[model samples]
Target chain A: MQRKLISGIIGILIALLIGALIMLVQGYNPIQTYAALFNFSLFGFYPLATTLRNSVPLILTGLSASVAFASGPVNLGQPGQLLIGALFATVGGLYLDLPAFLLIPVLILLSMLGGALWSGVAAMLRKWFNMDEFITTLMLNMIADFFTYWAISYPFFDRSAYSPMTPQINTNGWLPIWGEFNSNVIVMVLAFFVIYLVFNRLTAGYEWRITGHNSLFARLGGIKIDKNYVTVMLVTGALAGLAGGLVVMAGPHRFLKGLGANYAWDGVMIAVVANNGLIGTLLYGLFFSALQTGSLGMELITAVPREFIQVLQAVTVLVIVAGRGYLDILIDKTIARQKARERAT
Target chain B: MNIITGLINGMISGATPILLAALGGTFTFYAGVFNIAMEGMMLTGAFFAVLGSYYFDSWLMGIVCAIIGSLMMALIFILFAVTLKTDEFVTGIALNLFALGATTYMMRQIFNVKGAFSNPGIVPIPRIHIPLLAKIPILGNILSGQNLIIYITVLVVILSAFIIFKTRFGLRLRAAGYNAPSLDSSGVSSAKIRIWSLIICGVLCGLAGAFLSLGYVTLFSENMSAGRGWISLAAVILVNGNPWGIALISLLFGFTDGLGLLLQQYMPSQFTSMVPYVATLIALYFYSIQARKRKA
Candidate 1:
């Protein structure tokens, strides 16, 4: 907890310093900019809801990314799977004339299946051909994107419209809202707990860890490493797919092409910064959510361009990475010095 | 004749951006860094190129600005990934997100454009056709007429091949990627070599970015580079980190892209655009099988 807090403090300090530099360059008051960023996000009701709304898909995507990373395979296809999931969810909602209670779960389930099936291709390649999942998944992301664009722009395009999106999902299919908060928040909170249980305390988590640390060792110990790989990837894809469903059913009423909104990438960032831990991902998800929320308010209130927020995010990562770099140098130097001392002694 | 010209020109133009970006990725791979941020870097480069050209009214200035901008990014990446030993992939993704958001915000702030920008003064690279080459029928029209960047891309491809295969530095880079500790033991600073390779990569990606904005479109748009970075990465992987092979693979993708455009115009627009992505998958599958066979 202390380490996490210290890291959080360090991240904030670095962000503030960069914000100051940017303000100086752009001729804006740094303090005012920072105040605008926070005031609109935490204090304003609309902004707080928007932040939670933006974080809905991210929570799932972050969990998906963290789980995959924990399994030692980078699932770079979250964007692709999520897109497919959204499409599936939209279609399910549009065509199915079922009760709201029954329809929502079905849409979620089918979307998860769609995402899992899409990701299975990469998993199969890795297992059968020893293909690098990173490369395959990344490539598949574009393919998925192209597929969605084609679907919306051509066949499914609300041809009656100029927008690049499908018709809005049925009102019955829309996820219910509890006042300002979308009901999807319930799903997100529940998933966080589930992720904690599965990752932290479950036997499945131990199996995953064993396989992730060393496939050879896992295989030698009679664990079905290849099967684990396939299963784990499917689970990762399912979470991403669910994220897509959440976005569509809970937030956007229609299936907009590019709804991925780089969420797959954002989720990966959250997971990476969180270091593949469930709790860490949850915290970082909220932090990133806050950043996005604050940036929107900053844009509304001040001339501080949204790009500054991007620069701030980049600066945050850069500072973190550079800090790690110096730490690496220190460790290497220490190791070398220890070797020298051993020889001398 | 017009159709043939479009196909040929499209192949050359499309291949140029990917070839350069893949080469950039190749340099980082040699240095033992994945550099997935190429997409973001290319977008940043393209945005700066347009911004520079818009302000200075000079393509040369745009190209220079892009190179410098992307190189700065490369330097930051090297500082973090090499010195800090932070997860290379994480930093790459962060940089990409930074580029996307920053570029979009800049477009809104600076140009007052939401998604795309086009203006009269934003001149594209003037096309050039060889004198003797113009006499030839199909090949002349297809290959001869292109912007200045296409020629540079072809030249750089050959140059990169030569550098990778013939130079001692190339050998050291390859050695570093294969086994960094081994190179460290040999008194070669693996970090320095990696940093140099990344710098070279930055230059190539910058050129690629300039090609997209100044050479092809004459305008900058939000996320205009699209997934070209990932496609280039696919090209690099498909070629197995070989410079010559990478260029060839990029050309193959160029042809697929051309085919897609052609189909989009002539065939049903919907299914035609899917060709390039589908082709990528098929090519990747083939490449992976070949790789597996070789390993076996």
Candidate 2:
């Protein structure tokens, strides 16, 4: 934990350095711009609220990726899964006639099923035919885009609406919004504990770890590698789908195309940054959400582009990727220099 | 225009970038690294090529800029993946995001443009019509009048096949993927081979990117590679990382995309647009099933 914290701090500093350089190149005062962003995200309630809302999909997607990464498949298809979830959830909201409370939960669960089924496609391919899940999942993202595009542009497209999105769920089905943050944040918090329990208190967690570390070793140890891959993907896909569902039922209230745009990739980054820990992933998601929300103001107040946060986010991931190995190389260089000094003296 | 001719032309245009990117991807795959950064490198290449042509008014200079831009990205990948031994996926994915954001920011800052830019001053890559081939009527009509890069891709595919099968360097590169320890013990330095192959991949991807912006579209747009990088990776997987296989699969995917364009008049544009990607997934599934069958 100490090592991770130290690396995290180092990683943030490197990201900041890159962010500052970009600001400088763009002729903005880096310190002032960063201060403004932080001021909005940390002090103001509205910005913080926006941050919480923006993090909903990310937190879920981060959890999704954390599980997949732990179970040996690095799923890059979470966005597709999320979209599948959102698409179906919207369909359920429109067609299903149920009481508000029951219908909302059913829609959320259906979204989870949608995501799971989509990921199952990738997992099944991996299991039955010995395909690599990494590439398959990425390929599925594109396919999912088409699926959602078709759903919106043809079947679910709202005739009265100008954009390619489904009509809003009846107000009864909508999760009551709590100020700027949606009620889904509550469910997201609940999910954090549930995921922690699943990872720590279940035998399946052990199986997942073994498979992730080495399939050959896992099989020799009597773990069902194929089953574990399929299960993790299902759970991962469910979480991803629920994220999209939450956006529909609680936030956007519509099945908008491009729902969770880039959030799937962002989730992967958060998982890596958080080192795949459930609670850590949520914390990283919040941090990213704050940056994303605050960057909007930064663009208006300063000349910094909102997309610059994306650059910072990517740089942060890169620094974390360069973590322990990078420090070891640095220490080795230092030690070599000291030994050379001793020899000369 | 004949529907057949238009569909074939669209297919060639659509497939050219994937073909070049996959051919570029072949090197890194042989060297044991999944070059997921191909998308970003290609995107960077596209942006720099446009900038190159926009400023220099010369296609040659544009290509040069693209190569330099993509090579820098490749070197960054080498640093993280090879030198630091970082998680290749994280580095690759981050580099991709960085490239996307950086290019968009630069496009806004330098060009005073948002989303896309097309400057009339920029020169496109020339189209070549081989003299003898032009005389062959139907065949010439179908094959001729392609961007110079398309013909170059044909040569690159054949050359890569020969290099992979017959050359010492190619053998070592493959050994890096299949048996790195033995190659290392043989004093071949797998890291060195990995680095060099990635550099070559970068150059080829650079050319591919340039082709996308200059040859096909004559414009640079935000995320204009439009997941072609991922499609190219699928091509790599579909072929199980072989040069000739990459070529054939790329053409097949290209045709699928062209068919999507042609079928737009019949079906909903959204559904028709899915042809290439849906085909990619199916192709991967069938390829893996075939592998399993052969093994059994």
TM-score of chain B of each: 0.95, 0.97
Task: State candidate 2's TM-score.
Answer: 0.94
Over A1-345, each residue of candidate 1 has an lDDT whose tens digit, in order, gives 665556666876887797798788868888888899988777778778877877878879999998999887778889999988888888888888898889988998978987998899899988876777887787778778878887787767786778789888878888898778788888888877887788778988778888778878988998887788898899899999989988999877888866888677788877877767788788778777778779877888888876677667667756654564455577789999999999999
**Candidate 1 ranges with C-alpha deviation above 4 Å:** A44-46, A154-160, A321-345, B265-270
How does each model score on TM-score?
0.93, 0.94
Count of backbone clashes for each model?
3, 0
**DockQ of candidate 1 against the true complex:** 0.59
- List the DockQ of the predictions in order: 0.59, 0.69
- Candidate 1 is scored at a TM of 0.93
lDDT scores for all predictions? 0.82, 0.86
The CAPRI category of model 2 is: medium
Listed for every candidate in order, the interface RMSD values in angstroms are 2.6, 1.6
**lDDT at residue B283 of model 2 (Cα atoms):** 88
**Please, what are the lDDT tens digits per residue for candidate 1 over residues B1-296?**
78777887787788889899999999888778878878888988898888888889888888888888788778778777876677788778888888888888778878987889888877566677889987887777766777988988888988888887789999888988999999999999998999999999889999999999998788888888878898888888787689889877888888888888877767665466666667777787787788778888
Best candidate, TM-score-wise? 2
